[model samples]
Target: MGLIDRFQALFRPKDRENEPATVAMPPPRPSSVLARFNVEQGRRATVEEARRMYDEDPRVRGIIQTLARDAVKNGFELVVEGPRAEEAQDVAQAMLERVDFWSRIDDWVRLTLRDGDSFLEVAANRQGDIVEISRKPTLEMYVRTDEFGRFVDPMRAYYWADRLASVSERPPDHAIYFAEWQIVQASWDRDEGSRYGQPLFASARKAYKRMTEGELDIAIRRKTRAGMKYVHSLEDASEADIEAYKQRNQAALNDPFAAVADFFSNKRTTIQAIQGDARLSEIEDVLHHIRTFWMASPVPMSLLGYGQDLNRDVLDEQEKQYRRTLEQVAQWVTGQFVRPLLIRQWLLRGIWPDGLTWSVEWASKEVSTVAVLAEVAKAVVALRATGIVSDETLLRMLSHVMPDFDVKAELARLREGRPDEIWRMAQLAGGQDGAA
Candidate 1:
């Protein structure tokens, strides 16, 4: 048995089991508007002053004008549907036209709902009617039109208003259907940047298929709209379809290989995102440490600029080479995640059944005549065992990760003799990313 095998046989954990690691959840969004209406509906104080401000502010005159035009042009169509349907569609169109009107409404809603009743109780009471109307495509189309019309345009607003109103009035479970349509209407009126917009869009889109086929009821159909908005505002996961994503990502956080893959794969880009999030304070410290060690050091050329070039006077050629090697080693070792893995036997060499086993101890080192010969032997063995070895790959992967070593000739020889080491390096480079 090899030395590593013998050691493993004697000391390996017998059970070979690992406890499940808890996946960390991202922080929740700061606000939720649908949730407010769901719980506090009638109990919350009306923001009458803010509502008045919207109507009176000249900055919003453009929106009021556009909404009034749309409403008047299609007044016969809107009022023919129902009072709530007519009011909701007009309000949505008007609010969408005003600059920053959605932001103002969001702030007002948040303030009003601060001490109101819970949204769950309200949702529970409205569930039955919501399910009833969800099956109708006509109603579903109206919901989408009125919702999207506020921000985009209202070309088909009349048809949608009529469809929604008709569905709401149809069943024994009328209240639930009406409440659900209102929820969707409110969600449509929300600002684009508001937490709920995307998911609501997704929900509305998915429900469209069922509604088209006449399978879903008005109530269940409307849930897709509200649920989607709730999902969008909270997690931003709705950009991808929910059903497909839930199936794919359900065990993503639990799979170790997948976790490690995602970590390194997203290392360069996600590090910046983590730094930007207000929740991740540690990212700043990590960035500071990396910058100090890796890129901020004084250049050797700068020392010579001040005429401090202690040229050949201080050391012989061999001694100068040693200093260069030491500097290379220092540069390679700083701020690396796998420093411990490469530190102990970086310069060691061994003969084994698998060929000559050399430790990846130092990334940068001064070469002696004997050390050079050992490096050549190590390269030959690595090539023979792995079927590939290259100087550039070794320098980037193993040599750089352990400690710096200046082995230019060895690197060149390995490049010509062994090339498969590149693949091995890629496999080994799963999660030891040190970049901040």
Candidate 2:
């Protein structure tokens, strides 16, 4: 049986057509005026609003982009360990390269941060050779749920079967479902038993709004100098003179020949500018709002280049803690993102339980200097001299030090005993594009 057939057989109950949702919103309270007012006006920010913030706000975009990019900055690879491992690993690696896996993964991270949930769709050819990988917009897509509000097998999820309903559809139908074995959801910071993921910046939305409004207020204050006003200084004069002066001042303010217009004012009025001081000199409050917004985001201040006030030691300590956060994201990528694809791809090819095993080994940035890498290379070379472990084993051990280390190519060259081959492979392994 196919994947869908299998799921149907296992989980499809008799009332498939009429399965009542066991979860729903509580009934509205009609008696309380406060409840009615809240129902009418108190709408919360949504996933779409978070996306808008990511696109339009620099601080928000910075927090999300920084976390997403740095988490994958080191790199990652699928390492197959046993029987037929080389062929499987090679196929998977080539598939990833063809689809530009690294760039696509970066996009996935960004979308997940923006939308709180993201999705990926992977497909193979008729011969079960892995071929296609694509990112799906979370807004345009959704998952299926059973009666209990659990995503029906979130790993190999069920797609909404209303089947690409019109965007104009109000309260669209998400009732029917169809199963696809090759799709996966990448969600973080989700509530238990909830169908959707929480966006990274969801909690800080109010702060984001305040910060933007503050910045705008500051700009207006600086540019316009907090509104202009005309103070008519009258000596001991009659009401007629005061009225005439007011008319003349109004004319000057409205005169097209004047340098300042209704909003901008005229110089002939001997004006005392005092129209707007709403926050003319209160810039410090805006700064405070900005700091609050940054503090509310998931990223640390150090990651966002916030080290001016901090000493070297303090910055270094924060850096360490931030690295730990990145490591956690990496682990999630391995399990939630990488492993699902590998397993589903294998299951599609019927290669399960064939004594083959796979592992994910993510790379880290080359913080080690040339001397350190050389020392590692030297140690590896000594281990190779013992003739105990195969060269393939040794290279896999050091693959984390350099991504794209060609294990098979190096093994062939070592067997051939080409004197220059080791140097060439070493250079290539270090991300040298055109090493001689």
Candidate 3:
């Protein structure tokens, strides 16, 4: 042997018994509503169990096995079987017969997955289009995905069927009969006209009658997802509409919880379009664009629409003559009155002014806070003679100006120094001219 090989061999331990085998444990399940289904990690022995169940209960197991195969292929589990299977299927068929099977199925599927993590969880209803797989969830709340088979929508046919199976396992044939009753009732009342409808109806009627005579399948089509349709199946069915549907659905499925991100992204695209005024016809065009892109969204539509309406209202007000007068008044308040008030407040704080006022012609004069107060007092008295604002309105306006400046406290302090100033303000309000 080479020297290198010998060196490695010297360190090698003598062989003994092989290490004990360890069965790999399944991954930890997150504590979430999705865990309720108890989907087994890997294939496990479910197929075998299903097969054995099939052999033992051929009548029920037959359909269960077929559903199981579809489940495995579609990445879901079929939990319904026996009489329950017949009932849910009957109901499904009825729903399909009445509405656009595809559309109805999609709605039902969306409702189911609204609560759980289905592969089809991100699909949303956007405007009028069914966005199979959007970065954002659909308005209908269906999970969007790029691939049909990859993501499981809570409204998967397998899911609803599986739920039915579990109930059937517990309650016997009565559950199935009830499910049939529900389906038939909805189908009939809704004017469902499936070719198989009459046959299924007759079968349900016969079975229900037999139960009165004591031979009934007690199976229940337990609720899963929402609505009565299979939403995931629609996502899968979209595969035929065009290959892009499934692909898009799968992509959304890959990131099911990113509805906000998707919604914002769509919003961003719209905002960008309107940002450039050169591209749009006018401000109205931009506003309309926002309404279409932002307001039409499924979520917060009312909230967003309200804000947009308010903005539009303001714009509309600006166009009307009467409202325009109010608008100009507001502008004057902000620019002339409010701005000057703020500036005076700041200057008075620094200079410790007792009071201040200004000339309408913009000329300025001031000495101390007392002098300013005296000048404003005299001007107001003269103005009162001309009948501008009533004394009540002028007092109210003055009260607003020095709201926080404690007049009594300031007068007390001024009295300690210049008691004459206190008499001056008293004269302005009521003491001096008697016109007060």
Candidate 4:
């Protein structure tokens, strides 16, 4: 029977106990094609080849690293606010520092950016203290499904060479999965439900291949030696003489000095230099491919270390958009991976508090240069001068411009006749003008 017929038979309803008796049927034998399909489809595409190419290809690596670096450039903070808020925050911070969390997160981002999906197997001691967190290659891991074809929590993972490892073992709860992008509603029959991530550069594979081919073509063109066809009258020459001529010609071609010496001796020989085009067009084509790859990337060219001829306004806009993207990534990583890990740690440490709520805060995305801050301060002062904003509103706006601004303290000092430094500066300037 076909695979579909077998599936139907397996899932077909059985006669109820109260219903009429029916003969028990034997399970259908598995089809060879079905077995082969399961075996082949279950295996993920080998990432080593793509990873090797990514490493060797500077352009590819640059794009991937650019995206990854920007995503986690600002790092993140664990904000725990609840009954045990302070303790939770302290514990989380301590654990983060102990594990060098930022460095591990950076590695996770880079791997996911390059390989589509990155895995972190969380290892803990008997006391449930996280001992080590190591990255696992996507090629070595596989998903496991239950009898109902639903994915089993704690999926089966194994090394490619470990044929004896039982496929039925459930992965530990600490195994964290981070993917750059995933397809939704994909077919399970084709293993699309396996949660394997599609690499960002998978779409640009063809362009990369073309680029390599172009490079090879250019190299081959450069290394090729010009050749001249020799025509001689063999009518008067014996076989030995012809053989000797062939050997001499081969030797001369191998050595430029020998070829010049032979030129002086062989008066009957005519030399014609064969020339080829410089193939400068291939270089242009390769550059075009590189540009295409960059354009296809999610990151902007400026972020990938290409800032030539870029407008300041355009770059600022690109940075703003890129920062927003990074913020979203930070949110996703926190929700999907970091939060669970922290919660698990809390549970292990017996610090799991009731009604606990935690959040991850990324660094400010706005440009924080001195010039930018000055501009923001000017805007806030102008708004406050208009008298249209309330004192509370003015303080809130000023707080955004300067996080260290203390509205209540400043107000108390002003009420006590102590002006701010800026006010003192204005007074000094006015007194100097009067004295002059």
Using TM-score as the measure, which candidate wins?
2
Give the per-residue lDDT of model 2 (tens digit) for 1-436.
7644543342333445765665564433344324323322222246767878888977678888888888887687566778777777776776667667777787788788788777776656665655777776565555554324544453335453333333322224554333555567778776665556778877777887887898887786677765565665565657886666667667665663677544322333343556666657767787787778776565777666655678889877877877778778888777667776766666555555246776676776447677767676666656666889766677667766665565556667767886356755555544454433
Regions of model 4 farther than 4 Å from truth: 1-43, 124-131, 147-193, 225-279, 282-285, 302-317, 349-354, 365-367, 378-436
Candidate 1 per-residue lDDT over residues 250-276, each given as its tens digit: 574346355232322211222221112
Our model 1 lands, by Cα RMSD against the true structure, at 36.8
Give the C-alpha miss distance for residue 420 in model 3, angstroms: 2.0
In candidate 3, residue 389 scores what lDDT? 70
Cα deviation at 430, candidate 2, in Å, is: 17
Number of colliding residue pairs in model 4: 0
TM-score for all predictions? Answer: 0.14, 0.67, 0.14, 0.59
Q: CA lDDT, every prediction?
A: 0.29, 0.64, 0.29, 0.56
Off-target runs (Cα >4 Å) in candidate 2 are 1-45, 147-157, 161-176, 220-285, 296-298, 302-306, 353-355, 366-394, 402-436
Residue range with the least summed lDDT across 10 consecutive positions in model 1: 115-124
- Give residue 76's lDDT in candidate 1 (0 to 100): 13
CA shift at 381, candidate 3, in angstroms? 5.3
CA RMSD of each candidate after superposition: 36.8, 8.5, 36.5, 11.6
